[model samples]
Target: MTTTELINQIRKKKSFLCIGLDVDLNKIPQHLLKEEDPIFAFNKAIIDATHHLCVAYKPNTAFYEAYGLKGWKALEKTIKYLNEKYPEIFTIADAKRGDIGNTSTMYAQAFFEDLAFDSVTVAPYMGKDSVEPFLAFKNKHTILLALTSNAGAFDFQTKTVEGKELYKQVLDTSKTWENAENLMYVVGATKAEYLAEIRNIIPDSFLLVPGVGAQGGNLQDVCKYGMSENVGLLINSSRGIIYASSGEDFAAAAASKAEALQKEMAVELG
Candidate 1:
């Protein structure tokens, strides 16, 4: 989906929430285990129950990769279901993939062409050559890792390199790449205070922010600093919403959690 289309969905839904379909078989309702593809079953329920309250759904690739071929198949089914049923909803492959230039192109193809995800997360450690291949795709977004919410982010992202934080440098350097307009960024909600500085660099690029809810990042603080004129923030809540309950009412419980966030987002938009 294009940025315009994504923004339109946010306006129409009164939300910019991005539900993370980071399904864990162990945490899902035990009853779902009886199904042939429990992962997709769980994801389908969550998507069906909560799709209206959110604009995007992100399935972290690790969850699928863990189960091998079975898990991967479930992921395919989940994305196909979303594409066929809710074409308007933006989809993200939360696959933080980055490699050599040729390898990166194949990774881009797997997510963007074969799976048909609207966006995919990528690591920027390899520099422009690794990431430019993903950005080459028209209308498909390459969400580069910037200031992440993890505690380990301080190891490099915040460290000064050439008198500027590495995360800031990543934001600055990425803009010069071909088709850089299609780039979005991953900024942790925990680092809300830095968002003002981040915005000064990029000004208007969309940020796929995680670390809310279960990770204890404050929503109000993130919005205060990170929100752009177009509300360019996709606040993700994975465990808090999807794992709201471990019982048969899981889907409904997930919806309740999503509704609360959507309401909060609506207030922010207003």
Candidate 2:
């Protein structure tokens, strides 16, 4: 989806929430295990229950890839279901896939073409060639990793490079790429304080922020610093929403969690 379309959905839904479909079989309610494709069944229920409360759904590839071919089939089914049933909701393949040019092209095809995801997370370590192939696709987005919430992010992202933090350099350098306008970035909500600085570098680019909810990143702080006129943020909540309850009432429970967040977002938007 284009940035305009995404922002429209956020406004219409009164939310910029991105529900992370990071399904872990072990963690899902045991009742779903009885289904033909437990993973897809769980996802379908969650999506149906909560799609209206959020603007985007992100299925991290590792959750599916770990199950091998069966898992991949589940991923395909989930995306197909979303495309057919809720096409207006933005879809993200949180694959974090990046490689040499040729390899990256295949990765892009897998998510953007074959599976039909609107966007995918990409690592920038391989530089332009690795990310351009993903950006080359029309109407598809490449969300590059910037300042992540993980403790290990300090290992490199915050380090000074020519007197600028490496994350800032990533944001600065990426804007020069061909089709750079298609780029969105990943900024962890835990590092909400840095968003003011991040906005200074790219005031208009959308950011796919994770580390909210289960990761304990504060929503109020994220909005205070990260939001632009367009609500250029997709704050993600994975375990906190999807796993809100492990019993038969899971989907309803998930909806409740999502509704609470959406309500808060509505206040922020107001």
Model 1 lDDT per residue over 161-233, tens place: 9999999999999999999999999999988899999999998999999999888888899999999999999
TM-score of each: 0.99, 0.99
- How well is each residue in 32-52 modelled by candidate 2, as lDDT tens digits? 999999999999999999999
User: lDDT score, residue 50, model 2?
Assistant: 99
Candidate 1: RMSD to truth = 0.5
Error of 2 at 62 (Å): 0.4
lDDT of each: 0.96, 0.95
Model 1 residue runs over 4 Å out of place are none
